[model samples]
Target: MIAYSVTVPKEYGYVILAATSTFFLNFWHGTRVGLFRRAAEIPYPHPYATAEQISSASPDKKQAMYLFNCAQRAHGNYLENHPSMVIAMLVSGLQYPRTAAVLGAAWAVFRIIYAVGYTRADKQEGKGRLAGSGFWLAQLAAFGLAGWVGVQMIMGQA
Candidate 1:
């Protein structure tokens, strides 16, 4: 077998944290889906359904399920986007631990909160939207941090 280097750059620790956080978030969301499925057997209003229809649409299991699935998808997005940033940093040779840590922490917390808010199933719709938006914003921050790292690395100041 050909020798392969399995070493990850030091900066990759934060990337690992981000990835692990995504997994936890997904796990929580999956639990939400399980709860929703159980409740769904009795019929519930779908979150995506019309407001008026929600009252008559079986009590909203579908919507609850949607939040769980969507949160998982959001984590998938984080996983996808984070690696490119890590690779870019590695290639450019720029590693900023402080920046990465901040971004990763924010993203992780936002994602966790968003998942919980979504799964709660009793929060006001407005609150859920706000929480979810915060999660997205955190993701955007991670992207920005990664881009900055990549840029600094490319500039040879990394």
Candidate 2:
């Protein structure tokens, strides 16, 4: 029989905290979509209102639909990039724990900015682009860090 002990570094705890932020953000976004769905009077299994439906909707209904679509898109966009960023953050933590944690936290903040901006009444695109750029930069840094760590491990240098 063989026994092994694994001890995670204390710094990785910060990474875990950062990872938690993303889940909270996801929950918030999903909740907004649900709330908007209710406001729009949209039933389940109906992803979005049809063009004809929107055309015939009252002003308030139209606004609700607009908001609902915005919420849905925000959640969808977050889903698109979240998995890769999380993986990179964890992998980068192997070699650069503090840096990975910083990037992960910053990524969550950027996502917050993007989500809020995207759900706004005016100029969602500008805000999304700005904050989204920060997240993109964070993602690129995490990916580069992870790649370096992977290569170092392969070369037996890490």
Candidate 3:
């Protein structure tokens, strides 16, 4: 049998913590969204029912659908960005531990803000949504910076 090994820098400890924490938070949000769907009797396999079905349903069902949509969107957004963020954190932490940790932590916080804002808003666009969007941009910037630093280190330019 062939074996493969990988080495991670000691400084990556903090980065691991930050990445795991963010993952857990995203997982928590997804779990809550599942519960919301269950409570609404929206079925297990498809949490997002069609708009036509929601519009034709009873008032209570409609409200439940709305909440589910909001929660699902939050969960979906997290899932969409999580993998890239994790990769960036890991790579960057090898050379820039502090920055990676900070950015990861900030991303987690902003994700929560995004979920809360989307859940509470009657309309899709609101203060919380805007705030979350702003924070998300910052998180992306951090990731970009970290990636640049990691590249520089790899090239012996750092």
Candidate 4:
């Protein structure tokens, strides 16, 4: 029997670290989406929920819930797409493990806070957009780091 040897690039370790961060962030986002969905399925605040809670809810809550669902879907897209992105960087010989890990962790943290602020906010006072922006910034940072690493690899600086 011949055993196949999988060759991991020098950047493979960094990519794996980044993948860890992505996993955490996705889990956080998935939880929020699940909570929102569960809330929606309930009888408008359900049994234990207060009337104030129900009354204060904006009609846009539905939209917010939908957005959470979208985020969950987006998470899947990232899972599928991010590996290729990382692979591209790796192929370019660019790998920054610390940057990838940190960005991933930051993104995960931001998304959790964002989801809380987004879903629990009063309808008249929506904070989902702000939360969305924070997550966007985190994502941008991750991509930027990836780009920097790629450039270094291409320039033979990696």
Write model 2 residue lDDT over 65-111, tens digit each, in one string: 87778778878989999999999988888678899999999999888
lDDT of 3 at 119: 73
TM-score of 2: 0.88
Residue range 60-136, candidate 1, lDDT tens digits: 55564444444444445445654554443333323555455555567567666655665454664425534745645
Whole-model Cα lDDT per candidate? 0.53, 0.82, 0.77, 0.54
True lDDT of residue 145, candidate 3: 75
Could you give the candidate ranking by lDDT, starting with the highest?
A: 2, 3, 4, 1
TM-score of 3: 0.83
lDDT against true structure, model 1? 0.53
Q: In model 1, what are the clashing residue pairs, if there are any?
A: 43-58, 44-58, 44-59, 44-60, 45-58, 45-59, 45-60, 47-63
Per-model TM-score, in order, reads: 0.57, 0.88, 0.83, 0.52
Model 3, 137: alpha-carbon shift in Å? 2.4
**C-alpha lDDT (0 to 100) for residue 121 of candidate 2:** 66
Where does candidate 3 stray beyond 4 Å? 1-10, 121-128
Show the lowest summed lDDT stretch of 10 residues, model 1. Answer: 85-94
